[model samples]
Target: MKNFKIVFTFVLFLLFSFSNAQKIGVVDTEYILNKLPQYKEAEARLNAQIDTWQSELQNLQAEYEKKRSAFENERVLLVGDQLKLREKEVMDLDKNIKTTTSLRFGANGEITKLRSNLVEPFQDEIYSAIRAVVDKNGLGIVLDKNKDNVISHLPRYDYTDKVLDILLKGSDKKEKTNSKGKK
Candidate 1:
């Protein structure tokens, strides 16, 4: 019985030690993406596109307003087929404006599609970098600081900068390769 108890205690100690060996890391992906110039450029381009779309939408709305006002002013003068034609024209224009707005600004719209296209690559790159960092550091679990509800953590456990380093290094390598290819 004494020998069996000693073996059981030893096994428990080993299990605890092994369990404690795994390291947990936290990464702030948003911070890393903000530091990346490529991501910033992509975001700027998306913003510009959104601005252009908003301007176009505004123009369409102004046109609709103008037509509606004109129709209201000349509504009395228009009679029979003329009145029906003018009303139909205004309704058609309003419908066109709504269609354009929905096509460009709706939930599954052009802007959302373009944003996904522009941002997905960067997100993939960041994910890859995070994976590489985790592997390199032998981290057992990694959490996104932005996504996870992390109340407190040690600075040493924060691997955001390390992930960013990997990304920046990867970019540098690509730049070097591109420059060499150009030469």
Candidate 2:
């Protein structure tokens, strides 16, 4: 009985030491990005540009629809050569509308480039902020709350709110200093 108790105590001590030696942290990247002023500004700017493009596209569509309705209404009264010429004009307008629609709304190389241009810089900033937090906190491992599949059972204190606060404050200070320098 004495020997068995000694073995059990040693096993318990080993398990406790191993568990206590590990340090883990979690960060909600999505939350941080959403709350960050810089990200919000970038998103707003991109959305405004998209809105402008959409407005222009709407105008073009409206003009094209008006011309189409007029042509359809006048189709019965047209004669031979006049009818052919009018039909040709309608065809040309239809082609112009198709081209413009493709240019404005198509999922193509240009649109991809625009998305990358808008998103890449913001992504870089998020990554930099995360790195800053990790370095400052001396976190052994930082898991992304958004991507951690097994994190549903973890406690809230495992999250690195302190690191996030530091990162946000540091970024704000840097932005203010840069703005002052520019002025």
Candidate 3:
């Protein structure tokens, strides 16, 4: 009787442990970001601004090159005070070109900062949404598809679509109001 009772207790413990074992999942953030419409829009806006800045910089560079070439070609022809004045003009133009180039480069830096600022909030929101999903589902482990390397073969690997759906649904409500005011 003692042996049978001990055996029954062991089986029940095993069943309870098996039932309570954790379920885990992985999410691919890269996949989610790529699919999100808000990310696409931000990328497009940044690209457009970069294109415009590049076009302006190109035009300024062309003008600077023309000035430089003319200064070089005319240097031998001028004499005395005229040469000195021409040299001064060229120096001034060179300084102006340098200043303009620096400003344009600064704008490029600003664009990078803007991209980070825009993307960071979305990243945070997505992470929060992922956490919510994990909590609701009683997940014990949630792995980043970007960081993890040892996933050999899961029956399913991509939670990106589900995460994106959750993110977009939340964003739409808040983003629509913000966008309306901007427009």
lDDT of 3 by residue, 1-183 (tens): 999999999999999999998887788887788878878898899888878888877887777788778878988998999888878877887787677666655656666687788789778978988888887777787787887654654847455567777888887877889999899
| lDDT accuracy of residue 28 in candidate 1 | 93
Candidates 1 and 3: which is better by lDDT? Answer: 1
Clashing pairs in 1: none
**What's the TM-score of each model vs. the native?**
0.89, 0.68, 0.68
lDDT of 3: 0.79
lDDT of each: 0.92, 0.73, 0.79
Model 2 C-alpha lDDT per residue in residues 101-138, reported as the tens digit of each score: 67756777345567678678756766676677667656
TM-score of 2: 0.68
In the range 42-143, model 1's lDDT, one tens digit per residue, is: 899999989998998899889889999999999999899999998998999899989988999899999889989988998899899988988899999998
lDDT of 2 at 79: 85
Per lDDT, the best of the predicted structures is 1
Candidate 3 has which clashing residue pairs, if any? none
Q: Show pairs that collide, candidate 2.
A: none
Model 1 error, position 34 (Å): 0.8
